[model samples]
Structures are given as structure tokens and as C-alpha cells.
Target chain A: MGNSFFTPLSWNDTGFILTGVLNTVTISLVAIIVGTLLGLAVGFIRAEANRFTNILLGGVLDALRSVPLIIQLILFSTYVGAIGHPLDPFVTGSIVLSLYSMAFMSEVFRGGFESVHHSMATAARSLGMSYWQTVAYIRLPIGLRAVFPSWLGVALSVIKDSALVSVIGYMELLRTSEQLISRTQQPLEILIGVGLFYFIVSYPLSLYGRYIERKMAI
Target chain B: MEYEFHWIIVFQKLPQLLNGAFVTLHVSVLSMLIGITIAVLLAIMKMSKARIVSLPATLWVEIARNTPALFQIYMAYFGLGAFGIHLSPYAAVLSALVFVNAGYLTETFRGGFQAIPKTQYSASKSLGMNSVQIYRYIILPQMFRRIYHPMTNQFVWSILMSSLGILVGMDELSGETQRLQSLSFRTLEFFIVAAVMYFLITKLVLFSAALIARRVFRGDL
Candidate 1:
């Protein structure tokens, strides 16, 4: 077992593990882009609409927020499969990840938009700017800046969560590590490598998030 | 052609699902109790003036927060087996969760600690109280009160994150659901019910926390 630990895994095995990293990044990027767009729309609607509409939307988002993402991923995929139109693991996993992210992202954006003072919008309107012009020129920029740190936090979380797609047989980093462990019988080294990979992916984003928060605080 | 949903299969299995929910709650609550105690110490250490006292705490929180909980669980359950220090699935999941909970709540707790004015500590010290007395009488109550809402939020997070235990072969709620669904082949119905159960559990936590907060902090800001 001692020598087995020291035995180097072949370049082929290392390449296979790195493939999982690619899938992880792809899934996270697609989810964040799609989720952010959808979330922005929902946040805008929730922030700008009347009280009744706000309450209606809030309830739906809250439901999505309350349910754990693991359940959502499993339910959505299995439901699709049961209906006789089986989704590719990547497709279904992406769909659920985006939907899960959308809930938190919309909440972040809504809070950001609300942080913009009402007087700013009122003054813009008094200056004869249309609602859309005010939103485009003034509100959105301020809100996005305000929400950047929180948005980064959510994005980091997405990368971490992408690991869960492994449960659905999507073959991300954690699943790849499991495969490597079985083949090599070196779970300790393999899993430590797995943790290092995640830390590499997430720590910079976390540092950047802290940097943004500090920068914005001024 | 219409597809029929046989939710009856799920209903018939309600007892087992409820047991799974109980397991979920048990793990989450136990981990929180153990984790929060360690978190308090870590929080204090983070606030220490000496790097010797603080750096290790900082490192633990950074690693735990940045990485996925799944990785921790895998490392505990499968990784440690290589070193011949094997743990049961439940023990592995629980320990990993405790590690995570402490990491997150350490920050929350430190923030709570920092939010207090230094004058309070000086005031208590000037009253001839010892450091232990100062913390017990002055710091802890305020820290707990100030951070109560965030603590509740973390509690809910712990509850949800505990679902990762399923991957390690722990028969928690998600694991039970997977087991039952595989047997019944009523995948959709079982998962839908499981989702509802999870939703209700989290909502129940929120609702009860609010109730307790109202009672505990009555007439206080």
C-alpha cells in the first residue's frame, strides 16, 4: 500500500481526470450565463411590478429556493426520462443547475435594484427621461455594481454544485475521482487531488469576491 | 396518449420517507450542535491578535467554504479508507458536515463578535469581572442575539447540505428516495413527494425559528 501510494498514475489517467474539469467548467459557465439572464428578468419584474405581482413571483421563487438542488436535479431528470424523452445528462443537469441558480440570482439582483434610491429614478423621470432610458443609463449600472460581490458568491456556489451532477452519472470531477480511486486503490491521494482542484477553481473566485466587497464598501 | 401519475406508490411508502426525513433532521441537528461549539472557538481564534492563534482557523474556514461539501464527504468516507482509518457512512457524513458547519458559522460568529462595541468589554472588565465572566455575562448573549437570523439561515443550509450524505451510501432522505424509486420504478412520483417533504421540512424550520425568535427577543430590538 505504501508503494502503491507513491506509484505515479499514467498521463492517460491524468488526462481523463482533467476531462471532468472541462465538463465542470462548461456546466458552470452555461448555467451562470443562462441563469443570470433569466434571473435579471425576474428580478426586474419583481422589483418594478405592482404589489400583487411581486407577491406572486416571490412565492414561486421561494418555492424554488426552499427545495434543495439535489432533489430538483433528480426530480427533473427522472420526470423527463419517465415521460419517454430521456435527456442527456449534460442537458438535464444544465437545466436544473440554471433553474437552481436562477432563484438565488434573481433574489440578489432584486436586492441590488432596490438598493438604488427611489429619488434617482424620480429625478430621471422629472428630467423627461423615459423609464427604459433611466433603467438603462442609471439604475442597471449601479445595481450591477452593487450586486457584483453577491453574484460572485452565487457563481462560486454554482461551480461547487456542479459536482453534484455526478450523482446523475454526469462524470464531473468528484465522479472522476471516484473512478480513479477504484482503478488505483489510492483514494487518499486521489481525493486530496480532487479537493485541490476544487480549491483551485473556487479560491480565486472567493478572493475576487472579497476584493469586490472591499472595493465596493468605499 | 395520456401518461398516468401513480402517486399512490409514493403515498404507500410514506412511512419510510418520513423515517428518512427524521434521519435528515437528526444528522443536521447533531452536526449543528457540535459544529457551532467549535465555531465559537474558531470565531474567537479568528479575532485573536496573534497570527499564530488565527492562521489555522482562517485556513480551515477558507478550505471548507471554497470547496464543495461533496468533496469533503468523499474524502472522509472513501479517502480515509486508504489510510486504514475507516469510518462508517454515517460517521463520515456527520464529521464532514460538522467541519463545514463550523467553517461557515465561524465567519458569522466572528462578524457577530466584531459588531459589538469594544466599550462593552472594557465596561465589563472595569466592573472587576474576569474574561470568562465578561464573555458569559456580556459578549455571548449579544453575539447570539445579533446573529440569530443568520444562524437560522445556516441551520437551514445545514439541513439542505446534509442531502450530500446520499452519495456516500447514507440512507438519509435523498438516499431513501433513490432506493425506493429504484425499487418501485415510480421515479417521478417518488421524487416529487421527496421534494415536497424537503420543502416542508425547510419551511417548518423557518416558521419555527420565527416563532422562537419572537418569544426569545420579545420587546428587544
Candidate 2:
């Protein structure tokens, strides 16, 4: 080893790492927002629909959830490219991540929706509110509040799983760190820095997840 | 559109793919077993009133939980090499996985232990049992019953995450599939097969876990 204990990090390289961090966070946020909405829609469709629609939607969700996200990413990337469909890596990662999150989020929403007593909906309907009005004004709010904690868990998972985007050359934090290590041959310092970066990002969410669980428990 | 689905290429690669599946199964099962041992120890340590025990366990759990499994694997595989401690790809992946699994399972088991009523412990202690005996007879069994579902869920998660070991050149199912896809240039076929195999194995693992959980926690389930 050329340098002892503390070799200074080049600011330029660290800047590159920071940009990667921003990409990771952006992808995770977009995935969570879009995924939650899609999941809520699908989950309600499954819950409120006839047997055929419920089964169809449930089957789709199960298939999506069962396949590993990494494999799904590869499949989507290849299939899209093969079909002569041009999409950017960021867009591809977001789409795949959103689909992945939707699988889990739908289950969360389903559980939440079920927790809202049927009487609530029936009462709202009897009060001259339309079906859509009851869902929008009454049921969804309560259901979403109940599901918030689980959604937080799903969000944390999404953040970590988004690292898989590196496989498709997303140049996220993990990928950037990998490149830095290869170039600088400073695996220890870079890995520690990268690990710390992940810790900084994930630790707060984990604590917040626990906080949500505790608050929900109350 | 011109590319054909080559059944011949798939059939020829089936044996090699099966071998890869075996490797995947081996790594997952071994890691699960090792992980449970680590988890149990960590759980006990976390629950222990002693600071000496709890502090390290807490730190380990926090660090491991916060970092991604992929990063952990890279650190184990590459970080240690810088310190003149090199592990083979298999060993590195397994160790990293065991560490990751242990972190998650510790929380699961801790939750299970917490769910047990304090009176149960008191009753066991009153029955002329020592600490060890009380733990063996009362706490451990009850903990498993309460956490069986979550523990099994973590096991499935661990299996899925093991696919990441392909990064370290473990040549598991995903690794083998990537190789086949490259050689045959049948992207869809090879990947579709790999995906189906993964789904089936995950289902099998989950099913067995559920069955075992039922048997163990018959009354609770």
C-alpha cells in the first residue's frame, strides 16, 4: 500500500460519487411515488371488482412479485431493446422499479383497504355520496393511513433494491463506487466511503420505519 | 422478429442450468443454517441486559441492516483483500450472505421474543428452572412459534437476494443463465427459463418453510 491510514479523497472523485447518490435517490423517489399510485389503483380494483377482474389482477400481481427484480430488469431491458424500443437507463430503471414496488405496495394497500370496515363505505353510500365520492372522501384516506407503515417498509426495500439498477449500467452510487475502486485500486477506502453513504441513506429510513410502526401501534 | 426460439439450445443447456440450480440451493441452504445460528446469538445478545453483549450486537445489526447486501458482498470479497485476507468467491459470498441474513433474522427473532409474555418467563423460573433451562424450555420454543411466519419470510428474501452472488462470480443460477444467454444469444429463452426456475425454487422453498412452520407452531398457526 502506498499511503498509510488516511489517504485524502480527491474532491473531484467525491463529487462524482455525490452525483451518483443523487441519481439513486431520484430513482428511488420516482419509483415509490409512481408505484404507490399504481399499487393503490390495482389493489382497489382487486378488492372491489368481480371474480374475473379480481383473479386477473391478483394473478398479474403475483407474477410480478414472484419474479426477482434483477431478472425483471434484465428482461425488460433486453425485450425493449429487442423490439427496437428506445428507452433511457433512468427511465428503464424507474419503470422496472415502479413495477417491482407495485407488487408489494398493492398487498399493503389491499390489507389497508380491508381494514376499513365495510360499514364505513356502506354508510357513506347511504348518505347520498356516490361510490367514487365515498372512496375519495372516506375510505381511501383511512385505508392509506393504516397502510403507511407497511408502505414505509416497502419504500426502504425499494431504496436498497434500486441498487440493482447498476446491472444495466445506471451509474448509481454502487456502480460509481465500483468504477472508482477499479480505477484507483483503493478498494478499502472507497468501499468504506460507499458503505457509509448507503448507511447514511438507509439508516434514517429504517429508523423512520420503526417510528411509523410504533406510531401505528398507538 | 426474425430470431427464433431455439429449443435445441435450451435443451442442451438444461443439464448445466440444473447444476447451477444445485449450486444456488447449496449456497442458500448453507447460508440459512449459518445465519440462523448467528441470528439466535445476536438476538440473545440484543435481549441481554448486559451492555458488553448488547452494544456490539446492536452495532452489528445496525451496520448490516443499513447497508445493501450487494455492498456487503463486495466488501467481504474485495475489502478484505486489501488487508491481505483473501477469500474465494464462494466463501466470500456465503460469509456475506450469512452476515446479511443474520442481521435481519435477529430483528425477527427479537420481535418474536418480545411478543412472549413476561409471566411465561417468571412461571418457568418459578418451576425450579435455572436461566438456561428456562430459556431452553420456555423462551426458545415460544419465540420460534411467534416468529415462524416472519422468519420464513426472511428465508425467502435471503434466497432471492442470493441471486446477487452472481456479481462475485459464484456461478449460481443467474450466473449460469447469463453465460448461456451470451453463448447462445437467445436472450429471451435463456432468461425466461432462468426466471421460471427461480420462481419454482422460491415457491418450493416458501412451501417447505410454511410446512415446517406449521408443524413447529401447530397450535399457533
Candidate 3:
């Protein structure tokens, strides 16, 4: 190990870094897609359900939100193994990360759904639209459009939080860089690269979110 | 799928784990305080008319907001080490959390400040109030009230992120849980308790924040 104590980062490590980036992107996509579907469903239910149902669903989502994602990942992986179902890190990471993202996404979705004025729904009903028709035609399109910024915000965070899956040993960018840092012992260069990669991915999306938010405000 | 429970072993080490929780709370709260201080300054600078003053502020805010918190902590702990500035794990985590906190809070504070109309400032001046008196009596209070919820969310985020302390071998709650679980081989039980503790900690913070907001905002929030 000491033989390469000061090895400079070389192109040889690019494939390693690329793998990490791909893993990070892959897991993030899975979580965001799965989480959005779940959150969309749960958020809609919460919006339409009775007060008691809302409370129950809200409490479960609250637990997901309140705990740190790392702990959830660790607890989840260990619990699953203890229960005699030892899955791979990627699978475990996806499950926990998706649920975690879903917690925040549901809130965004709920707010989006509720942001539509009661007047809009009444207007649709007066036009003789059915309940689902009013929802699909008016509320879904308008409310989802209204929440583009928030949805982007949560999705971007899930991308960032995907790094925590490394705790469960699914090597994403940060963890991949970590392994490289140990091998190369060039923490500064590797870490800056990792930070830059995340910044590159996140910054433009954030700008887009803001731009749309401004557009929608008008 | 049959598994025997070992919660008793975890319960036996509760005090040790609680101490770690205190450290987690301590680091995050301290980071939040320092972060808010730096963020306020950064916000002011970003809003300055001069490019020279605002450029660095903008860079700092953007980098902080865009990068992952895990990256920030590692950069603090290990990245700075490459420059021969060896810091303790606690110091590194604190500095990183403070950096990100300041970054995000700068935007929040800036937004809060902008939300206050310039007319309010001019009207206060017309009321014969000096700048300090106007800020103290009118502008500052309202600005804080506007940003209070966002600030609370930042605090909670900091709390949750401080769990990254485990990675660098800082004996925060997660790290301590990891150590204890390794020793006792009760990983699931220990982590489950830690999860509960985190849930409780965040809930307590939100609960008290609500109480404080109720009093501070006087039903406004």
C-alpha cells in the first residue's frame, strides 16, 4: 500500500471514476423515478383522504423525513440481512434512498396539489367534468406545473443524498473517490473532482428550477 | 426469516450512545450559529452593488448549495489535510457544516431581506428613526420572522448531516452506535434505537420551534 503513497491521479483512474459516476446517476434515477411515483400517489391520497387517514400517512412519511438517511440505510441493510434476506448493496441502497426521497417528494406533491384553488375545482365541476376528469385535466396539469421548482429541488437533493448509499457499500461518486483517495493519497485533487462533478450536475438544474419558478410566477 | 431480538444489549449501552447524541447536537448547533453569522455577512456582501465584494460571496454560496454535504465534510477533513492543516474530526465536521449552512442560509437570508420592501425602510426613515433604530424596531424583526421556518429547516438539515461524523470516526451517535454494534454484534437493534433517537431529536426540535414561533410570531406563522 505504501508503494503508491503519492501517486498522482492519472487517466488510468478515469474508468474507476466513471463507474462511480454512473452508479451514482443510476441509483439516483431509480430513486427519483420510483420515489416520485410513490410520492405522487401518497400525496394525492393525502389530499383526497379523510383527516384521520392524512394523519396516519403523514406520520409515516414524517418518520422517513426525520431520520438521517445514513442511519436509515444502515438500519435497513442490517435489518434485511438479519431477517435472512441479504441483498446486494445496490438493491438495499435503492430501496432506502427511494423511500427517503419519497418522504420529501410527497410533501412537495401534496403542496402542489393543494396549491390549486378550490375555485378551480369548482369551475371544472360546473363544466360537468367528472371527479377524475377534473383531476386529470385541471388539477394534475396545473398543480404539477406549479410545483416544477419544488420537484426539482427534491430531485436535486436526492441526487446529492445518493452519496450516502456508500455507507451501505454501494460505491457512488463520493465513495468511489474515497477508495481512489486511499489508493492515490491525493485527497485534495480527488475531492475537488468529486465536488466539481456534483456541482456541475446540480448547478444548472438549480438555475433551471429558479428560471421556471420565475416564469410560473408571472 | 426468523431472527431473535437483542434489544437488551443495545439498551445496556444507552448512556454511551446518548453522550454521542449530545456531541451530534452540540456540533450541529454550534455549526448553525457560526453558519448563520457567516451567512449573514455573505448575504450582505452578495447584495452589495460592487462586483468585487459580491463575487466571492456568490461563489461561496453556489458551491455550498450545489455540492453534497458529504463532499463538504470530506473536503474539510481530508482536503484541508493535504495543505498540512490537520484538524480534529470534530473541527473538520464543524467547519464543513458551517460552510454549507452559511451557503444555504445566505440565499435564505437574501430572499428574506428582499421580501421586505424598500418602502418599509424609507417609511421608517421618514418616521424619524435612525438606521439602527429602524432595523432594530422594524426591519430586522420582520426579516427574521420571514426566514424563521427556513432557518429551522436548515438547522434540522445540519443535525441530520452531522451524522456524517460517523464516516470520519467521530463518535457522534451513529459512530458510537457503529462501535457498540460491532463490539456486541447487535447491529440491527443498535441502529433501530439510533434511528428512534434521531426521529425524537428532530421531532423535539420541530416541536420547540413551533412553540417558539408561536410566541415570537404571535400567531403570525
- Residues B1-221, model 3: lDDT tens digits: 89898778888899999999999999999999999999999999999999999999999999998999999989989999888998898998999999999999999999999999999989999999999999999989999998999999999999999999989999899889999999989898898899999999999999999999999889976
RMSD of each: 2.4, 2.8, 1.3
Q: Give, for candidate 3 chain B, the lowest lDDT window spanning 10 residues.
A: B1-10
Assess the local accuracy of residue B85 in candidate 3 as a C-alpha lDDT between 0 and 100. 95
Query: TM-score order of candidates, best first?
Result: 3, 1, 2
**What fnat does each of the candidate structures reach?**
0.83, 0.57, 0.91
Alpha-carbon deviation at B172 in model 1, angstroms:
1.3
Question: Which portions of model 2 show Cα errors greater than 4 Å?
Answer: A1-9, B1-3, B124-138
Candidate 3 lDDT: 0.93
lDDT of 2 by residue, B1-221 (tens): 44456677987899999988888888888888999999989998999999999999999899888888888888999999899989887888788889988988898888887888899878988889999998898888877677777766776776677788668777888888888888979888888888888888888978887787777777566
Q: Arrange candidates by lDDT, descending.
A: 3, 1, 2
Error of 2 at B88 (Å): 1.9
Q: For model 1, how does the per-residue alpha-carbon lDDT over A25-51 read when each residue is reduced to its tens digit?
A: 899999999899999999988899999
Decoy 3 TM-score against native: 0.98
Q: Pick the candidate with the highest DockQ.
A: 3
lDDT of 3 by residue, A45-158 (tens): 988899999999999999999999999998888988988999999999999999999999898899989999999999999999999999999999988988889999999999
Instruction: Give the 10-residue window scoring lowest on summed lDDT in candidate 1 chain B.
Output: B1-10
Q: Taking the tens digit of each residue's C-alpha lDDT, what string does model 1 give over B1-221?
A: 24589888899999999999999999999999999999989988998999999999999999999999999998888888877889987899899999999999999998898889999989998899999999998998888898898888888988898888778778888889889989989888887888888889999999999988889878584
Q: Is 1 or 3 the stronger prediction by TM-score?
A: 3
- Considering the two chains of model 1, state its CAPRI-style docking category: medium
Docking model 3 quality class: high
